[model samples]
Target chain A: MHVPVLKQGDYLIASVQSVLSDADLVQLRDDLAERVGQFRSRGVIIDVTVLDVIDSFATRTLRAVAHMLKLRGAETVIVGIQPDVAFAMVQLGLTLEGVGTALDLEEGLAYLDRLARKPVKHGK
Target chain B: MENNEACVSINSAADIVTARQKGRALALELGFDGSDLTLIATAISEVARNIVNHAKSGEIVVSPMNHSNKRGILVVARDEGPGIKDIAKAMQYGYSTNKGLGVGLPGAKWLMDEFDIESKVGKGTTVTMKKWLH
Candidate 1:
């Protein structure tokens, strides 16, 4: 019911370990907060490849995770969403517009790295 | 493939997959290819799930498109339960009033050619979706 994979480094990386259930989704939200509560990072990447379905509760948690991380000066990225899952989302009219997404874990990490390296623009 | 086919019924979430399978079979028998049949089935499943999660109970109607191409499938799902009071807010990417990924309606809209949703507070919700077979 609970299997999480998180990357270690300047960024916090987490992945859902199994089928997402109503309870697991809630736990993930809490775990995300507890894990990144003290870390000073640029972003967090959550791999969702193993998840076959995303229900309303799960969506809410994802949004919460993003919000919590943002408050800590970090962004959230969701990766590896399956086609059926993606289709289901659209049918239900779900969108992750503000959150970052990648095709897989590698690309997600790269995206985070890219965001981390972006130079801040300021008036000279 | 005759256009004189229609089936409507109300079922629970446990029956959703079987209902979708039946719908896809009906579409295939009516000359829709595998891909398009799958699309219709998937859309039906998503919307039906919405009925179960949000409305609690509903009916699903599947009919053939009555157009010149004769290559379209129409699905209408209606639920006589707590209707969606805020369509615009529910349509947002991360705005889910229930416990889900909030991707169902938007994703279903993407799978088909046309999609429409109508609902009222304390009345019910109706979702009409159509997919053209190529």
Candidate 2:
């Protein structure tokens, strides 16, 4: 499935629409990471609400994508993980560790806006 | 589609989707819904992916089962690739011989109600798993 990545202000939003194959997930990661740099996006929101099964491969790939975007100086927040998909992911020992998550597109945009408002912190 | 069993040949990533799609259809038909159906489909994805990543080729057979009291879905993945030499070690987390997170096997095991693996070096491997409707 092709995931549409749209730019809003300084952030990118990728809304996944259907079941994704392994290759599709990998392609999305590469595409998002590349676009983050090209568009100079400040944050990215990946919406996976339509995905019913977030399995091991998908989980691992998404985690990697988040990290990749982080290194590109873009904050990543995964939004719209369904309740059922979340439960199944947990049951399969998959967790989106170290990745930011929000409820929906609006909340995700709000999160990015809040980050934009906060003063950039120095080394922790 | 009305049949109780479905066999999907696996080679590429698309086959994985097909198998899991078939699995989801069967699970839904068996009256499993919500997270339970997702669990089954996810388990199938993990196993089917293993076939694509490690075995290079395999087939997954999904069917419905009825015990004396409970009913569930059964999934079996078989491959004639380089089989695992150490089943126990392969089951451990963070142990991978390829470019994967090494969680597929154990994760699939965790999702299903029952899981079994049979393998022989230089021969083949078979993974059987089930998730019951509760």
Candidate 3:
């Protein structure tokens, strides 16, 4: 499945519309990381609205991808998770902890924008 | 009694996607609504992924069923791989032997109305799940 990752300003928006396999997911992770570097993006919005199923592996991969992007100085937001998919994920205990989530792509982009506006504090 | 039974083989990640799509199509044909269809499809994906990740090969059977005044769909995923040594432990949340999230089995169970598991050590594992058309 082809996943289009488009750069808008300083944020990268990836709309995932395919039923991804393990290899495809791995490739996406690598691809997104590379894009983040090449584009010098400060945030990413991953849209999964079209997916009917978000299995355990996919959930984990998303979480891992978000974590990786965070390490690369980019904030990540997941949007468009269907209600049934959310129910199954929670029931199965795949809470996708520590990952930022929004209701839709618009909200995701806005959330990232808000994050970008926050003043950076040096050192904890 | 099994009727309108369909089966799909699982050997790779691509097969998992196919099995879930087939499950969703079968459930849709059985008059399952959107939520029910997603639930069934997600359940199928979990079990089929297990076959690819742990078993290396397996089969998923989807069938329409009727009992009393109720109608539903049945899904059976069977894999001949290294069987689960501790079924109970494996069913617990966040318990994964393969360094995974350990939610496949238990999560699948929660997605369906009825769930059953059968496995033998050093043999294989079989999971049967059903979702009623409500």
Instruction: Give a tens-digit lDDT track for model 2, residues B34-110.
Output: 88888889899999999998889999999999888998899999999999999998888767789778888988899
DockQ values per model: 0.15, 0.76, 0.68
True contacts kept of 2: 0.89
- The digit string of per-residue lDDT tens for model 3 on B1-134 reads 34467899998888988899888988988899877887888889889988888899999999998889999999999989998898999888778878998888988998899999999998999999988877
**Which portions of model 1 show Cα errors greater than 4 Å?**
A1-3, A7-11, A17-24, A38-42, A50-61, A81-95, A114-124, B1-46, B49-54, B59-76, B83-111, B114-126
> What's the true lDDT of residue B65 in model 3?
86
> How well is each residue in A1-124 modelled by candidate 2, as lDDT tens digits?
8898998878899999888988889889999989988988889999998998888888999999999999998888999999988888877777899998999989988888876453455796
Quote model 2's TM-score.
0.94
Which window of 10 residues has the lowest lDDT sum in candidate 1 chain A? A51-60
Per DockQ, the best of the predicted structures is: 2
Candidate 2 residue pairs in clash (backbone atoms < 3 Å): none
Candidate ranking under TM-score, highest first, comes to: 2, 3, 1
* Local distance difference test, each candidate: 0.72, 0.89, 0.88
Identify the CAPRI category of the predicted complex in candidate 1. incorrect
Q: For model 1, what is the error of residue B15's alpha carbon versus the real structure, in angstroms, after optimal superposition?
A: 8.6
Q: What is the lDDT of residue B66 in candidate 2?
A: 82
**Model 3 RMSD, rounded to 1 decimal:** 3.6
lDDT tens readout by residue for model 1, B65-129? 76775566788889998998889877665556765656667667777799899998889999888
What TM-score goes with each of the models?
0.55, 0.94, 0.93
